[model samples]
Target: MGHEYAFDWLDQMVHELDPQRTEPERLDNYQSIAIVEKAASEKKRLILLFKQFVFREQKTRQIRNSVNHYLSAAVSLMKIANNNLNQIPTKANNFRLALESVFSCLSEVSAFIVNRYRSHVDRDISLNLVNITPDAHDLRTLGNRDAMKSNLKLSKLVTEAFSDIFSDHRGGEITMRKLDYWVSVSHAVTYPNGLLEMTTPFEQLELIMIERNFNSPLFVKYLVSKFSEGIANSEDPSSRVQALTFLQKTFNQIPVMKDIIFNNQFEDLTLTINSWFIQEINFHSERSGTVFSDLGEQTQKASKKYERKTSDKVLCNLTVDQLSIFFKAADLSNIISARSLSAIFQSVAPYLSTPHRTDISHSSLRVKSYSVEERDKSLLIDIMTRLTEQIRDL
Candidate 1:
């Protein structure tokens, strides 16, 4: 089965690489013959083919393994194509196009692997890539002059291809070393400066946090450290400014992050950065009272029937004591009507059978409130589990 997949990919690549099938004239625009479109239609088609192969192989294999297969197959195909260079027509650039297409496939596959499996990548796999392409040859190989020039041109295309992917930070689970590898091998391609030199790791870290809605505790820790490093290392005012912007945006949008950042443990950080967060925390604290008021307004605008039904459904199974515990914990005693709350309890557990009262009063419910015991905690947990299960079933 593996051999069959190999044969299929090879056959398809050979057909695409055929010099006789090359149509350089097809690159001409109909509106004007004077300008030849720079679009590498053949290269795009080859990339699309490689993408299809990746997706097809994923059904039978793990995604990482499939990408490995793509790398192996792409290398083999390029070497085979290189050996057959003599077959090309004298004046045609089809051979160059074929080589560019394979390199582009390598670039695409490398970027995809880094994006999807940053944490799981087998670093040893890159060793297989040595000597697989003309670019891998040392410059001292004076006999391979044409191949060297081709390598230079293809390297630029690969680098240019990286521009779009790198423009916005790509997010995934990654270690610091692995991230450096990715920046070097994927983003930089031919020449790789580590993530620290060209850009701040904080932006990509921000992306990872954003993916989880900024709830990641570990990444929050990383964010603090990276911001410190970025501020210290960055000589450019614009870069530091950008990092500060990201920091402010993150704290402003995520309340939990604000708490984490303002915790007493982070005092080891520079006083300047610490003071910035302190000002933000103080400013937010000033407006914190409006949060509940805003929620109340939104809740009022929401369907009253839905709110009543949700409140009733959640409160129905609880004992009077449990209801009292919940109301206090949730601080819903003043927000929710005492009469409505009492009626819901009475309706579910009959007034005579349960500890519920015939008349509605906050004082009656408040009198039932007690310090939550083990059984009461267990009961609340069970109720929460059942409600979540119901929601899931829906």
Candidate 2:
């Protein structure tokens, strides 16, 4: 197919020249102008053909090959036109038109190709279709619901087909690259709806929590309890793990909720503890505590004195080991009811065995600089051993 297009282009160029003429200069200039014009026109025609095929319902492979062939020919013609411009030294409108045509053709072809491919790529390919149909009783009462089901089913099939096609690359190698393109396209198409759907899950979860009239601590407890039940009932290990992780994350959000309620005084403390614990457990720091600082700063006018005092104490007094206590406490018991201040103290005992460095030199009161270093390590180990023993007994 490409070969045929290239041959046609070459034939057009050959027929554009004059072989016999008396005036050598006139003939030479005329031949150069004719060739430039012919190449330009051919390039323009190819561009038009590409546009038509791309827009029309036709075989993807055939359209792709034809477009590629025309594009190649157009590029070659552009080079020839440029070369002829220097050789002829004439202000021929044909060469200019040809060059402009090449530019226009390439622009249109590139845009059309990119847009067509991009239209299909989207993240919603992974999302399941949510049917929005009303109940059968309501539909029967309304008397206008049958069409709605048909439309919804059609939408589901289309979305599923698109996902399956992109997943498997049924269209061959070309479609593989088009997957990324379609991803972008899908993002654009479904972004608005995605944002709406996002609110729904959180809202549903919140509504369930709100019905209990629970504070942050109690809310977290409820979530953990429900999550544990969900995990126990779940047969799939992956689902269980996901549910557990989600519950832990939900519990972790308690400190943030508390900060919001208390006007952000101890937010930094919460974040700092979270960061250190994540680093210890996951071997990676999640993110910095800057957001806590930002929240404090935002509410500084109203809570300046409170914020200053709490920030100073949290930032200066708390050690990494102390923070680890909070994290361990967060995971003490499977049932939320089993977790209390006592449980927190119990969780902290193990970490306390590995006492952090304590320097009293900076204390406001002029206290004796006694070295507790001798007992710190041994004391920490003893506490940890006791905690372990207690946990085993339980």
Candidate 3:
């Protein structure tokens, strides 16, 4: 009976495997298959999750690599732009284009990283990523666009980066010199037209000459040449006056440049004006005489001990010749009289010469009565001669 039971059990297990089983047996078999299907579905879901994680890791690596590559390219472009000082315009434009490309690529990569893993990346890293975006925009709009704030910010960045490279001690001087050249060239290129426009590179060079203690003979020669060019190109009288004033103030700072201003042969600038005055005196004799006579009267009055107090009280008291001297001096003199020359002479003459005296014998008088043009010529010659003497004493 035991052997018969064992055979029946074995036969029953085999019967359950058949598709055409009884209803109760079929229900049990179907339940088992459903469980197996559920387990397989769970396994497939887990495999998908693992694949997504791997893809994300790979993408992150790619983005980081791209960011590094673009950063390097941007830095390299800036260096290349700086190195080619003479060709700054072309090189700077190329650098700007290259920087734009880097920025675009970086933006795309950063956006990808931000969108793909917004929760995973650090906030600071994301912010830094965004910072480069505006920098790109600024570089793009530098010359083509009229944006002052953006250009200034860009300039600050460039200057700061340069300062870092230049402020070091080891091989830093070379780097600093390179940066200085680059700054000069870049200023020449960009600032010539924009809101940040500056005077010629020589103006800044003059400042550098003062600041850097660059007391070389060649440097002074270069500075003088630049000053001369500035004076030549300056169309505005005020600007020319300002240039000469600055030149005068900085004159003592440059020992080597003293000859350029003081030496008679090289700089017969005063003679040029005097020759002009001689011609003008002959042309406007009556007008010149009246103006000079008024000046003489004023001088004579101002000199009198009794009239000094009254003369001091008079305001708007310039002699007609005093005013005419400036306006007509240019017409009388063929060369343009530097307004500075007129102003300085007027200021210095009172202390240098004795006040005119009517009681003095005409023969003893060093002052000669002459036409307006002649008086102007005499005044210019006397003033320049005194100045030349002073320069010699210095």
Pairs in clash, predicted candidate 3: 276-333, 288-372, 289-372
TM-score of every model versus the real structure: 0.23, 0.25, 0.15
Model 3 lDDT vs. the true structure?
A: 0.35
Clashes of each: 0, 7, 3
lDDT, residue 369, model 3 = 21
Q: Which pairs, if any, clash in model 2?
A: 120-182, 121-182, 121-183, 121-186, 122-182, 122-183, 353-380
Q: Which of 1 and 2 is the better model by lDDT?
A: 1
Which tens-of-lDDT digit does each residue in 7-64 have in candidate 3?
1221232233232333322234445454345434533443343335435445654534
Higher-ranked by TM-score: 1 or 2: 2
Candidates in descending lDDT order: 1, 2, 3
TM-score of 3: 0.15
CA lDDT, candidate 2, residue 301: 44
lDDT score for candidate 2 against the true structure: 0.36
Off by over 4 Å in 3: 1-173, 176-184, 187-219, 226-243, 246-394
